[model samples]
Target: MIPSYLKDIGKEIHSNKESTKLKIICTCGCDEFKLFRKKKSREYIKLEKEYEEQFIKEFGRGFEMQSDLNGQVFVIKRNIFGKIVKKTEIKKLDIPLFKNFISVKCSSCCREYILFDENIHGYDAVIEKNQESTIVESKHYSDDSQKIEVIVYYNDDNEEENINDLSVAFGRIKIIKITNNKKITYCDFECE
Candidate 1:
């Protein structure tokens, strides 16, 4: 979930003419929406640092925790006290990476739309703009050379005046790369 203040800003953006062209219409036929950039708060960043410090203090320098895009955190533990450090255990932690998303809320029915999320390793995003449209593309690549792309199309003038607005509206955007064998594509559009 994003901060309420950001949602308030979204409501303000929703009132803009350019925003009307960029909003995703709700199933209820409402085109007005509150847009929010999902980002990590300062407190969250500080806590994350503290957690990393504590994790290193408890498990030593070589041990580390891994987090997936779905917000699952896990650590591998070995039986260090035993004579043989062969047995290992996998433990899940409650910490979640809640950042890196774009959320939109319908002004009428209050429905929420979460976009551009992936649960794979090596995730990236790219934003491309021509005179007529802006395309936000997200890519996920696997070690096996498989890549999946999700592209969101925004039809607008892409002018300087609306650049800041669009940046704030879309939050953190990312990019993609083509792999050896397989490619998959998915698209979503928001236009007047």
Candidate 2:
């Protein structure tokens, strides 16, 4: 859980109108889950609730949550861009359906979006458990100022180890961005 002090700061940030926007992940690919292993409506609903609670505890309140568009658009209050950047990096992540357009939305008036899920989760899990990693550019933003960066986290400690089963454990990330014009842009990592 985020510390209380940080939540207070997040509240203050959300109150500001001129805050920059950030989208951690966004997807544009096909995976096995989309073609097979379909989940029931109730299962999707439960997943949405679980993700919402986790998002709220990790992020904060005043954010929007929904399960429309295949669990897309988990909107959060604006002004949490910095926090998103710092926390978006997965330590031991796992998910099985992130490569199927499950985007997250940010209601900062600027409309930020992110694509994250099983693929990303699997990537992080593999990297944490194995040793090989791959970084690739997945998608770029329509905005000239923003670019989408997708990194595949993996680890192949044993050359004979097969990652086929890990499709449900680790994968890729699609980042949607909304740049802050006022902030000085530095490296590729600098979003604003």
Candidate 3:
């Protein structure tokens, strides 16, 4: 069972200002999390690169994660000579690389955690309510054959900026992954 501290208020990932709508209660029962923003700011860029490395290591050799035009993940396969052979996109989180992810330290454990789905290799997002992420698009490089996945919500908000703006308004978000095979797990409060 999911602990009471980790219940989802169900707000979608709509904005940066109302992060609490996600209602991420620290396991330590304290409210002293350091929220990180999504942007090219010095801190965010540095953190993003590190986060990228972590994903690469987690996904391993046969699978690689790269960003598509929408800033989501695309996987690629490499041959023995490290030559690119195939690339595929993932139908997962919108901000592929921990965009709105934050680092929070539990007052009780003093352990910092980054919310992540151990199975999905991503976060639990309220993407269903996103007004700006409606599209079904894919890209293919002229060389080195590959395929990708698209998880389009088909909303009217085609504008990323407009969607970002809506994020600040309202939504419910959660951090759990379940499969039809009956696999279910709460997102890991990864200690950093």
Q: Pick by lDDT: which candidate is best?
A: 1
Which model scores highest in TM-score? 1
Instruction: List the candidates' TM-scores in order.
Output: 0.27, 0.22, 0.22
lDDT of 2 by residue, 148-186 (tens): 223222233323445444422322222333344333321
Number of colliding residue pairs in model 3: 13
Q: After superposition, which runs of candidate 3 have C-alpha atoms over 4 Å from their true positions?
A: 1-22, 38-100, 115-192
Candidate 1 lDDT by residue in tens digits, 1-192 = 121223322222123332221223466766544444444669888888898898776676787555668766656556756333332344655677442444455666766655333221111211322222212253222223222222222334434333423432332223222345443322332221
lDDT of 2 at 90: 29
Of models 1 and 2, which has the larger lDDT?
A: 1
- lDDT for predicted candidate 3 compared with the true structure: 0.37
RMSD of 1: 18.6
What range of 10 consecutive residues in model 2 has the weakest lDDT sum? 29-38
TM-score winner between candidates 1 and 2? 1
| Candidate 2 positional error at 27, Å | 17
